[model samples]
Target: MRSTIVRIMRIAGLAAVVGAAVVAAQQAPPALVSEQELLDGLKADGSRWLTFGGDYANQRHSPLTSITPANVNRLVPQWTFQTGTLGNFETTPLLRDNVLYVTGPQNVAWAIDARTGRQIWRYRRELPPNLTACCGLVNRGFGVLGDKLFMTTLDAHLLALDMKTGAIAWDVTLEDYTRGYASTLAPLVVKGKVIVGVAGGEFGIRGFLDAYDAQTGKRAWRFHTIPGPGEPGHNTWSGDSWERGGAGLWVTGAYDPELNLLYYGTGNPGPDYHSDSREGDNLYSCSLVAIDADTGKIRWHYQFTPHDVHDWDATEVPVLADLAINGQPRKVVMFANRNGFYYTLDRTNGKLILAKPFVVTTWARQIDSDGRPHLEPNQMPDEKGEITCPDITGGTNFWPPTYDPSSHLFFVNAREVCAMFYAWKPEYKEGERFTGGAAQRVTGSNQKAIGALRAIDPVTGERRWQFEYLSPSTAGLLSTASGLIFSGDADGNLLALDSRSGTLLWRYQMGATMHGTSPITYMLDGRQHVLVPAGTTLTAWAIPAP
Candidate 1:
């Protein structure tokens, strides 16, 4: 009887071990992210948000309709995750496999559980003491592929981290941070290559965009925003001016798969606001360039605000779409420029289809037929100062705008403010602020600064409707298929607006403002969730389970 009992016990132990192994295998993730998955963009199931702009088109529009305008007011906070760091979030978080990969200020990142808002892994970089990050010590977000996440550092380096464990897979330096070069843009992954741009436009550093091998961290090609000696646009800048021209690209751009081109808007020239400092149009600066993704060659470019002196950097996001203009199907790129112009251009050859003022543009009344601005008299700034309508921040800044393809409406948070701009000759000093100008906000009884969330008809350059704010808001925007637009006021109020009519539907005081980040939505556990990053905390909201 004892021998028989021992035999049965051994068999039971073996069966238990085998059953545990089977369960583990079943629970494993499907596989690392595939190329086709990235190309698929946002799906109907709402399973992931794999790219920065939700897709290559840079349209922050989601297809999920569970959280409709009628039901969005019913959302309740599921969980809140705090950064516990110094600065605020300027990132667009990426979601995959029920996990959120987010990058925050001061080079800190986290992988959190989508279900519970729990941190699964955290990654932080030890930055140097004298870092010269001009804008803020912030990281936009990560670019993911296979098993790794790619991020640009404030110390001018690019790193690939293991998505599962947040371990550094590879690290490569883009430039010396001490020379006033820093990178804060999110990496954009396209076809086995990671593309990123350096930021130091205000510090007298020449700008360039780089492509690196995603697997090995090897640089594939470099495209200088400022043309070189033999380059085509080299003559656009005066002698030796192109060496330190500031066409830095700190904002993420859109990509077209069929054209195999990357569209990026460059920054203002160095010594900003002083026209004589760079005597020419400053080729590629304050312009949009269509670049060959495979060869890093410039295919075409359209300069908006050529030789801009109002500190207008064309770093605003470029959105792509296919529109039927005048009964002709046209593939076009739309841009609301900081120089106070809204433009529609042929994405194929960079030809202007239509250009009009979306705000109070005093510098120019309109864009001429040949795509040049019809400049107004005495608008340029000098030592005595000149009052410009859109101010130095322009009508809209670097914060993103959204596009709804179904409704054919483009939305942006616009500021209506004027500024007195003053400019003088500046001396060049490496690793120091190089702007030779200043802007003072115009304020008085009739000139109060105000903001509005405006829905624009891109085809006609007309305002469909606008929801006004008490103060000028710097927050980005997001839209959904269920007819909801998410935005934040300067006063820490998160708003849900009806996308069609711009009617206020719901408002919640988030306790902090979403500075330059837009809220993202996805479906989790059969409930649609809106993930918002405001101040230093990330909060997830969803409707109650039925």
Candidate 2:
């Protein structure tokens, strides 16, 4: 009788503990709002825009239709605030209440009044002079939540600032910038957690996405792109290739709150030209991985380029949308991979719904039924040399693309070009840092048609329309419900195109190439205005009151 009572008491105690755990999990703070609700909120009121791409769908689409195509001709410069910096002005200004938060070179952040454009406060992050940057010194944007403005520094530090007064709340180092890891992308906030990805895939850093507690700077979790020994996908890499594998998650990702999944694109495997050292399909690299936001577990993945030989890193932002496919409404995640192929997958299950070439691609003959690319064996880089179309860059799209839900068309700026590639055995020396690969490059004869803005149908992978430019495009794009598409060019032209058809509606030259940032639209004092940070100045345009 005593033994039975003890056993029953222990079992009851265990059940109570399990019950408490279940209740605690349920009582935890509510998960972030669904992606659709976030998008709807942005479209409803143009106030309190807290994210880099305005609510994570990253459509860059605004529902405010006050500035239409008809009156866009009357647009005039409202105000321009100069940051007095020298690098590219790729900052996307975030509007909250009536204050605007922006970021620039060296991770300098400014809080200004949205209506008057007067400086409220400024947070300057002190960075090392010897910082290594693969590209120019540029930060895409910052994130706002409650009373904090979060951003990443050039030296790979994530800093949070007080929204009202520019004071540092928390400063945490993201990576060792000395080891070639730096962060330029904005910190994405989801469910009270700040999510960030590391850049420098070319500099030979293993890629991963990290989540940090919003209130405290403690790390919540990390998801490594390259698997290690005893890991589930370790077999994908061969002979210690996992040590230096390059799968950097440089860009921001999209989240689906309905399914509780975060979709992020991974970059290429390292050693750029020489893939002989790392054989087999490098799992997770050059793919779109769907991860659980709370637990950081990879739910599913779709690889765009397995064992990518070229330097085509799949670092572009994945856009989410609901579209009619085969007479059924399917939730889809669309991305134009750097390898020159546009892919659409079922956002819920990682099923490849469609895949098509968006640019001048010659390496792969076609994307097979199982969503794998059928390479033309000769197109792979050789020990001697091989001429590859769509070079290290890719077709027309490199930066973030915009989607118009009204027209169901995806707008992308692309490059029509190719390159000559030669892979050689890398010479490694002990105790000296090296990328472990050798390469020689030659420009192709048909390296022209460098820039073209194309409108594509993500459903069919068809080009609805295209706008060609004299120079290759490096800037990003934005769209609005007012039937306007905004993008910049390498020639320094900030242009507005008709959303339905790719027609040039308006253009303004800012005197320098627009690189790596998208335009934004907002309402100030009951008047809609378009804003683009060019070079070092934030320029705002509005229809002059007549």
Candidate 3:
């Protein structure tokens, strides 16, 4: 009887321990994000979105196909999340493990439940009063690795927040905001480094892209967009122009794991339209730079516009892909540039493979065989103002584009607009607008500034098909394997088009335009959800269960 009682007590103790462990497991946090998962890009399972461009290639294309062109119309709103802040979202929210990590305007961020579109934790930064952020007070997005989320502020600082609690892990200053430096792009996480760049091109701030240690906020290296005195591209900038040359990197870029290279597009030169003050090719600015990921060295660069005078920054998104061109396999970086040209460049060496106009380009007829543009007469802006096609926004701006590998097509929201550019010699002051010129949209009877969502054959630069928007759209794009391309109109309509034919598959009025943001899709609870950020609200859409 004594032995039986002892055995029963031991069994009871074991059961109690087992019960405690089960409860602990239930309360444990989700698995921390791994680098392999980020390298996986958009998986077939549609589990998570780990990066800014949905993958390092910056494809913005997904592999999920649950909602195809046929049933995309049936997508219904599951839930809506409002920022309840002053500014709209200019960010591409990151998703992992059914939780959304989103950044908003005014340095506000949140961690929300992916299944319910409910807020889990929110972060708001107390910005300085004397901010000289050139554009809107917007943050592009967040980058995550392990349990920390990295973000850049309008006050020119990079912060790593704890992924679980929205608490700041560490913060590092990128530059001083009072001196016209601000960081707006989403931090791109590669390997174990968090890569980011600064803005304030209009405020005469020299721009540089920096990589930081992911665990600590310590900066690893910085590559100045404007080359220094003894740098190889130094001669490209005559006189002291390279100091505030304004090669701002306000958009996220692509990464190639095999090459270990980060490809980023640089912004315009300072004194934007008056190139005479700072002459020469202005190396790096208005260019696409390929940098060694481990080292802050430029492997090679291709300037889309040499000595750019029209305020056209080459800050458009770069999409990397491997394609067969001229009957040969080619590794290429495709760019729909703000200079009204679409280029396919050999990614390995920064050589131009092909260049063609995707819009009404009057600045230069075409890029010559030597990779220089054939300049048109009287295209330069002057005191009297000169008219140029593509206007100041070029053919497109910073809105993210998408590429569908299966379709062999590149998609972008393009604008057909022209502007009268006026330039003058302006005095430079610290922490002030340094653009020596301005542009006015041409509203002549013959010039109608309409917009279109165009699908282009990257190999031939030929238009496959296009859907016209009443006005130029500032929305980014998203494409899926199901032959659906998601876009937004300036008139506040969310649209899904047939990727193969540009047919209108579905449409919904979101009441506010997407502006500089794009919709992201992922799987939640066995259902595919499309998250749309228009104005200040994030609305999740999914088809009702049958």
Worst lDDT 10-window in candidate 3:
1-10
- Candidate 2 clashes: the total is 5
Q: Which stretches of candidate 1 lie over 4 Å from their true place?
A: 1-30
Clash count, predicted structure 3: 0
Identify the superior model by lDDT, candidate 2 or candidate 3.
3
Residue by residue across 25-95, what tens digits does model 3's lDDT show? 23236578888888888963487888989999999999999999889988888777777778789999989
Clashing pairs in 2: 395-415, 396-413, 396-414, 396-415, 397-414
RMSD of 2: 14.2
lDDT of 2: 0.76
**lDDT for 228 (candidate 1):** 92
lDDT string, candidate 1, 395-471, tens digits: 99888999999999999999899999999988888888888888999999999998999999989989999999999
TM-score winner, 2 or 3: 3
Instruction: Note each model's CA RMSD in angstroms.
Output: 9.0, 14.2, 9.7
| True-vs-predicted CA distance for residue 283, candidate 2, Å | 1.7
Worst 10 residues of 1 by lDDT: 1-10
